[model samples]
Target: MTRMLERAPNLAILYPRALVKRGGGHELPDTRLGLRDVAVERERLTEYHRVCGFGPSDTLPGTYPQVLAFPLAIALMSERAFPFPLPGIVHIGNTITQRRPIAATERLTFEVRTGNLRPHRRGRQFDVVTEARVGDEPVWDSTATYLRRGAGTGAAAPEPGEVLPTTAVWRVPGNVGRRYARASGDRNPIHLHPLTAKLFGFPRAIAHGMWMKARCLAAIEGRLPEAWTAEVRFAKPLLLPSTVDFGVRGRDFSVASGGRPHLTGRAVPAPGNATPHPG
Candidate 1:
């Protein structure tokens, strides 16, 4: 019975002109690739590709966008000029639609824009839409909602809607962290190369964000009613060699570790859906 906020009529205006004026528009300089570099032949995409747990010959994994997308969102939202408290937000859920396959060596300019904004019954919780583009072409898009902790604004929590009970649970082992890094091309030293992690303030290599995402999807597909829409908040990053417990209860779902909740979400069966496959 947690209190939540009612949907706002002007929720879309949260990213006000003032907030947009505070900083440059959503532009990721580092992500943009010069046209000349876009077609260059390189072996890095094929060689030394263990970071994502994928061989150079393998295709980019589904959750690969997190390496750049979420970071870009954080950077834009954290501008001191912006009104919302970026750190206080929780990533409720993420949905990504890929228009085409992304080559590892392809260089391109990337941009993001905040789109739809819908308020949830939970106080201060709002759904935000983010769209990513490469050189004027929409490449991928995700809609994520977040719960603003400690922001007591608007209405009381709504009664739990249709309940979809848990079906199964999965235990994510520490080693899967390493394997995920190898499959994805993200060799961020934080997820591999222990020495690099130490320099970056981590005790050891941590799990790739995408791996955790994949794990979540796997859990949901196994338990909840099929076709349920999921909205999740990333909250804090989960480190390596950690044990994660994923479970479902009624229509509510939760992922936890060390007795602490890492993600909280809900799901329902997809209309005209079939059985889910192992991810």
Candidate 2:
């Protein structure tokens, strides 16, 4: 595993050069739509609906982004031509903006890209920006930071800021990890393969980040009002067979697993003119 991490290429190599070089600048591809023909048997929205501790008919779980985003991320990351090593990298953080509510039946395309790559003060660490679009409409954008084990400058931590508004909390069950993997077709060994996770230094398979996100949305529901935008930062990985507490307080919502915070962020109700909730 260490050898694999050492050989991992920089994320810059993963950019679709042909696409980026076209028109003299980085250009995102046309939206690529995906059909919802696949039946959702295991990790169906119904399961999350119940776990969210919300009543029936509430908006679809926010983590719905995983249904498309995770697959898209995987597809791009797995492209042989892409530079980064799939097994060597860790997903350090994620930020999502929901331009519109996602419906169970809506056909959606994903527009993905490896954005800016900047070196962190820590020698081997770097941050990569990624974005996803639904059709011509931009749906979500996120920036993820990665630490290249050998490359850090070893600088002191930055100072802290005033406390942000708090989010509500909901409890996540231990068994959902397997459930999400079964439903999302994201049976990535790191998430479901115990041996694989141990090799990667995790005690056990972890819950999909999207699953945790979905739980956050369910926690806030009517508390956030319609059309609101929420942005979450993953602070830690949620290990398998663990329960999480999630909720929105003031403008913030959080998910904590094994007594450690996994994700935290603020949400704003969507503007009146924004897209309405889809059934």
Question: In model 1, where do residues sit more than 4 Å from their true spots?
Answer: 1-57, 115-123, 126-128, 134-137, 154-211, 217-242, 246-279
Q: Residue 28's C-alpha lDDT in candidate 2?
A: 26
Task: Give one digit per residue, the lDDT tens place, for model 1 in 20-60.
Answer: 44433333122211111122124433322343334343333
Q: In candidate 1, how many Å is residue 50 off?
A: 6.8
Encode model 2's per-residue lDDT on 1-279: one tens digit a residue: 001111222223433232233122223222232322222333366665664344555334455544544545544444444444455555555555555555554434444445444344443333344443444555444455544343656564232122333343334455566676655556656676567778778888777776666666666666765455666666667776655565456767666644556777677865433553252
Candidate 2: stretches off by over 4 Å: 1-43, 47-55, 121-150, 154-173, 243-247, 257-260, 270-279
Using lDDT as the measure, the top candidate is 2
| Candidate 1 lDDT (Cα, 0 to 1) | 0.45
Model 1 residue 176 CA deviation (Å) reads 9.1
- All candidates: TM-score: 0.47, 0.67
Give lDDT: candidate 2, residue 178: 63
Candidate with maximal TM-score: 2
For model 2 the TM-score comes to: 0.67
